[model samples]
Target: MEFLLYKVHGSMNTFFMLEGEEREDYEEMTLKLAALDPGIDGLLVVLPSQVADAKMRVINRDGSEASMCGNGLRCVARYVCERDGVEEAVIETMKASLHVKKEQPQGDGIAMYAVEISPVSFQMADLPMAYGGETEWKLKPLPFVSEEIPFTAVAVPNPHLIGIVPDEYQSNPAHQQKWAEFFNGPNEYFTDGVNVSYATKVEGGIFVKTFERGVGFTNACGTAMTASALVSCLAGLVPYGEVAVYNPGGMVKCSVEKNGSSFRLRLTGNATYLAKQQFKWEGTSSESGLELAEELQEQALYEKFIEQTSAVTNRFVS
Candidate 1:
């Protein structure tokens, strides 16, 4: 049967979003759909949820399911809210049920949304990163990388290893990629792998690049950027309020507040829809052929909007 789907992005971390229920082969199918031209970071499977507006399942290109994906969550939030005719809704993710609300458009044809990324924890047991049996991993020199560069681990429900690095290393893709791959691949620190990011403070805000766990070197990883914002604040890299985060794909404004012991993060960015299509999903990934239905041109407007943002000049490669 033919099924409708969307090509969506938040800060250029693209995904193919489709409505579906629980399935056994979703991982395999994600690998197929994410391989489309101008490849996607992953596939977002929006499912019916009894507890919330919708359930968002993020399947990475390598066929691994993520506990949480903030970028994918924003796209799914827009899709379900528009479908069900709601302005605000709570999305059920693997780790937490998140609140999402539509916002004033960032630009012409560019829809904006803000979603909560939380249940934040600094405890090493939460991320389960092995580091000298420490309870919390924060601003400590990890000898593997460099003593000069200190790393912090945060689980915004997605384990992220954020290292506050020098501007030269942050701008160096090779340097970041090497460390990310090492940690993600049978390493001593992160056995199950980790979403690795190298961030550096810049005028106005911070510039971040992430090498995602299942997907390597994405233009952006929403949870990673959110974690970076929080860690930057904890490390006194930036003031503990609103900060603009620039990535290779685009920019998002993040704010972290101390909510008792744990923290709370809110991510606001463009949830731009690029195109819509229909595909025959006859149960197998190989047989499902995608047919382009319409181009929304939201991507063009998003690009224009990013160009207008203040931090665009500080943007660099991932």
Candidate 2:
């Protein structure tokens, strides 16, 4: 069937697209897609209505679905806006309401979008970490090699653990690997799974590397960035204003504000436009005509995707 496709990178280098419906055998499909082409990174199952209205389901290359994505949301916001010709939009993901606004152009001929992420909550119940009882607060320290880094567990729509890395940990791959292993370990105490971030204090901004739960070692993560910024502020790494996060994909700006016990993070970044073309899938069958029918269904699905996102944009513009 026809599906909306995009080569999204940054945060993690996943070449993914949005499918209208859930696959019959998600695991097999995921493996197939990853093997379909060398550039096939991962797949994301999105509820255009739900995410734009409430939340989106993130399906990884391994066919495992997760709650949210930071960089992916920025790409989605831009996709919905440009495809529908809108300016401002509010997208709902599994976590919170994402307030997206179109921004001035950048150098790469790609449009920029500003997505306001949800507040940060350290409550174990909010993170819903499986191991811990629903408590008023949750915090911990992880030792990476010889360095012990203190981190706060926060949810920026998605769950995350943010820690500041000293200069020693910044260049040590072994430290990063150890940190990743600890997060993946059972003792970490996140029941619902968590994304991990390591930050280094730079002159102008902070450098971050993330180990996303569903996806590993990504360049940048929007939610994680927001979470990191707020955690940094709480830990006195940066001030409570606009925080620039340097990721491998590129740099994005996030603004934070205290909201009672929580904080709000606003993220800004560029969304690049790849080629647009028709996708045709062929199945070997005695009923060649049925294959044609399947193709028609796919095309219809793609049209529906376009139409739904278009409606979302129209509502914002109109």
Candidate 3:
């Protein structure tokens, strides 16, 4: 069967979106489709939903299904709303029924959307990290990652371990890769593995470097940025309000609100459509018949927008 596929990105966290029911070979399909685009981080398979506008199931390049993908949610939000001719829609994720709405146009052909990231939990059990008990892992010592840098575990439906480091204390990629690999592979801490991020303070914003669980050193990780923003606010590194988060790929805006003992986060960013393709799937062992249908100029404009911004220059943690 032939179907139209969309190549989309949120804060440059690229994904391939297809509108159809999921296939049994989704895991194998994810691997094959991801190889098609070097920049692709995951595959967003849109499925019909009885509870919301659509259901988004994220299959990472490594063929692992994600409970929730903040970046992918924005791209899925834009796709569903545009397809249904609406401005607002709710997307059913694996963990929650997230509310997503179209935001005012940010120009340069950028499709902006705001997604609600909630059911926030700090309990080690929620992340299911083998940290003894259900204690809220706050700014405490994590000797495994770094004894000097304190870490916090957050579950915005997606488990993440965040660390806020100073400019001079930031680590290199090889260093980050070493620790992230341990926790993600077969470690005593995260048996299921967790998304790791190291955030740094800038003049007026924050820079986040992430090692996603299934996807390694990506240009950006939406949930990681959201988790970084929230952790920054909790640690008082930044004010508890709107924050500008910059990453290697691009930048995103996060609004953090204090809610009792926890917090609520709203992520607003670009959902740029890169191109369209027509593909047919035959079997798990075969190649996905992908042909370029059309391409869009939004990616170039997005790069121009990023170039004109100061976030690119403010990147500290490399």
Off by over 4 Å in 3: 132-134, 168-171, 285-287, 310-318
Q: Write the per-residue lDDT of candidate 2 for residues 56-101, one digit (tens) a residue.
A: 5566665666566766777677766766788887776665667888
lDDT by residue (tens digit), candidate 1, 1-318:
776878889999998888987889888777667665547888899998889888999989888989998888889888888998998999999988999999888767579889999778888888879878788888888886788988999899999999998778865678888888888888677878999998888888888889999999888899999999999998898987788998888889888887567687999888888889996766654677789669987777888877765354454652
| Candidate lDDT (C-alpha), each | 0.85, 0.61, 0.85
Query: Among all windows of ten consecutive residues in candidate 1, which has the lowest summed lDDT?
Result: 309-318
Instruction: Indicate whether candidate 2 or candidate 3 has the larger TM-score.
Output: 3
Better of 2 and 3 by lDDT: 3
TM-score of 2: 0.77
Rank list by TM-score: 1, 3, 2
Residues 1-318 of candidate 3: C-alpha lDDT, one tens digit per residue: 666889899887888988888578778877878776667898998899999989999999999999999899999999999999999999999989999999987755677999999779988888878775647788887865678787899899889999888765444566667888888998888888999888888767788889999999887888899999999988888999999988877788999999688788999999899999887776554555788559887888788877755544444433
